[model samples]
Target: MKRANFIFICADQLRYDALSATGNRVAHTSNIDRIGARGATFHGHLTPNQICSPSRATMATGLYPRHHGLWRNGVALDERLPNLWQALSRAGYVTMGVGKLHFQPLLAAAEREMPESLAYWAKPGSERWRGPYFGFDAVELVMGEANESTRAGHYAAWLRRNHPEVVDLYEPEASPASRAEDLKEVWKSAVPPELHYTSWIADRAVDFIKHQSNRPEPFGLFVSFPDPHHPFAPPRPYCDLFRPERMPRPTIRAGELERMPAYLAEGDDPKKDPYIASGEQPREQGFLLRTDDISAQTLAIAIAHTHGMVQMIDDAVGRLLEALAGTGVLEDTYVLFTSDHGELLGDHGLLRKGPPPYRQLLQVPLVLCGPGIRPGTSLGALTSHIDLFATVASLLGLPAPATDGIDLKPLIEGRATAVRDFLFAEYHPRRDACLYNQSVITKDWRFTRYPNEPAWGELFDLSRDPWEHWNLFSESEFSSQAHRLNSILDQGLPPQPLIPNEVLGAY
Candidate 1:
């Protein structure tokens, strides 16, 4: 148990049905559903490369984007190759990577074009992510988690220049509710409900895990959480803790977009996209933009304010798992919750996970509890997230280093000898609103291959449309399961001419 230390816990676009241990009867996780009752909860996990800095550079370099090519999201990861904190600090652990290390930098020296936002971030500098990328030894950068007063711009200017509210719950539009219609999430029918930014990223991730268990080695913390991702803000009695009259609508069907598949009915002039359009989302007064987050009255009050900000990030993952079982290190640390991708929240009317291979933005949520595994078990066969760098290098016995992923300790220990049986996905659209697509799911077929540029391609038959609401690649009744996941997405990935950003150029 001592050799295990890994505490990962990343969450951004979250949604594996926002957890109630996955049954989600309307999520409110009593401690992120007790981390699936203490470990092992695959639930068919998958997310090879689905946006967000190429899925946080394939989980900090377990490679895939054709082997660390970082397939898109403001480009940037050619950090001279080989990562995962340089193979867990060359096999000794102690990694540390607090909140949103979507890291950016590597290419700089005057605008050769890349700083498109963050007000032209130091010329080629702005690609989202300000520093320490993933070589985290320590990092805390929460200057703002979406404008509109959240953390009152610089945490209320450093709590009016140092702790004045004294927990009186100061308010700044309960800051951190940036959904942009000029930022929102207004609260205060009298104070007591402020301090938001998902409780300032869960009390700075439990005081950086109680300052890294007051040092003694054996650590790898990477606690990230940017809120129910995007300005569908959170903080104000968890913004009306869901009840847009029991929200939950848009399971999309009506005229079933005339039999999907021409790039999912091209939902936004990808030459008339109606591919079961569910593109934009954010309501309760505004947002819903991929040309309107399709009404059912703005998707039931934006899915009850995204299920009350996923029960306030499951009460901030139950206060970072009660500060890791009150420092007894919760059965010897390993805890690896998930989500760098996943959140089309509206499901098909897509809220924001950009256009491509949408299984509500490529099926994410790959829980793996801790030490050895099997606790309230759930593996559903397929899994990836580049196998968390060979399942944390086989839980620290080490050795799968420069990872391209695939060593899920024999499917989180239920044992089945899986070296991956068809599951791949990728889409690079830097933004023409969002469209490029490519997907290949297998243990029963789900191919999506949008080549119309704007982005569209789908094929689901989860044993006959399991709520994928029908989109069978021009049904010849599932042309041999969409030609066997498009010939395994044309012979799986990797081997593209990459590597060469000794700053920014080749890769």
Candidate 2:
């Protein structure tokens, strides 16, 4: 069998149900839906970590956060580890990476020499530097999430050099109407949709596909979009695509946090809290709107803005598909679409991600469309971001690297209905702090365990509480159920290292 060309597109902080095909009626994602139309969409797909860098590292190396040594967002992936891109390159494939490649710290100290750092890119000779980053033969990146002040990488340079007039338009406070005093994160950007970074990423990806189609070596292209991550600012036309009134109200059950961990509940001061003061648990600082303080209108605006960003990405995906088809490699290539992790768009009274392994932050979309893959099927078996590396190696006929993930090719080819019984995720935010969280999720249940606080944890019977509104960890009636899941969690935990990995920076 001939080795297949691969095109993997990833979104930053996209929810699983953000696409129209995923039953989101408010969002128009026709282009993304095409991938699902031509192939299979995996359900119960979760990220090993909720944040950007750790989850992306898992995808790149096929190892859990602990194994890969990127236990948090600010840390860098170990270069010595075998990554998917380098493996494909060794197998005679041309590897290309475009857009947000958050494999390194984006906001580290100036002396750290992090390539993804804004300060590094702003330096004099940084313009000429590109290639062999994280094993990609070539790369074009937008370092961090969409923020005007913090913009850097290849995209920022291009915008400044050619389209300087539109730089200020990228600011959240550019337009008066976009400035929502109540919700600082929600904004309608003044920059035109065509000039947006999402469009620029698509442009580069299309060019790469068009250019590579004429070459002999099979290509492995990763086009990662940074939109839909945060600071929900969509450019004009796309920004107005969804109305705030039409957006669904967030699912916030009254007094739901009381059942969960104490950190999740409001009116708890970090300075006063023993766990936080002792540096055992990281502080749960607000990420934009607080769950209890957010008004319905504010939440609606943020959701609508996020919907707009999704719509923009959908249109961009359409362009890439067209490029592939136009280059005559549509049938010869496998196109995989997924997100690094998900966002908490007002789910369970949470505004953004945190230590808790909630469904909203962990469950992301995974669509595999290509030859020999079952089309129009939805596989509900447990899956994780780590699986992609092994799956890709299998598709390319390369020796699968030593990885914690299983070969998902069997599930994709309809050879098996189930591959794994359970999925695992972890989050260790700070080295100094003991906020080590491990979660074991089965088809019927979701359980998160905080080792430091054995008495406080989360156990949700997915069958009954699909929304995860109720935490059944402390309930005596569900003690047996929690115990079984806790055992599974114990098996998933990796052995602690003798020397802890260095924390490069705070994310």
How high is the lDDT of residue 313 in model 1? 72
TM-scores of the candidates are: 0.33, 0.94
| Residue 360 shift from truth in candidate 2, angstroms | 0.7
Model 1 global lDDT (CA atoms, 0 to 1)? 0.59
User: Top model by lDDT, which number?
Assistant: 2
Model 1 over residues 26-69: C-alpha lDDT tens digits? 77676766777776777777786555667777887776665676
Model 1 weakest lDDT span, ten residues long: 269-278
How many angstroms is residue 66 displaced in model 2 relative to the true structure, after the best TM-score fit? 0.3
Model 1 residue 451 CA deviation (Å) reads: 29
The parts of candidate 2 lying over 4 Å away from their true place are 148-150, 176-178, 266-289, 431-434, 494-499
Error of 2 at 205 (Å): 0.6
What lDDT would candidate 2 get against the real structure?
A: 0.79
Give lDDT: candidate 2, residue 296. 82
Alpha carbon deviation, residue 353, candidate 1 (Å): 11
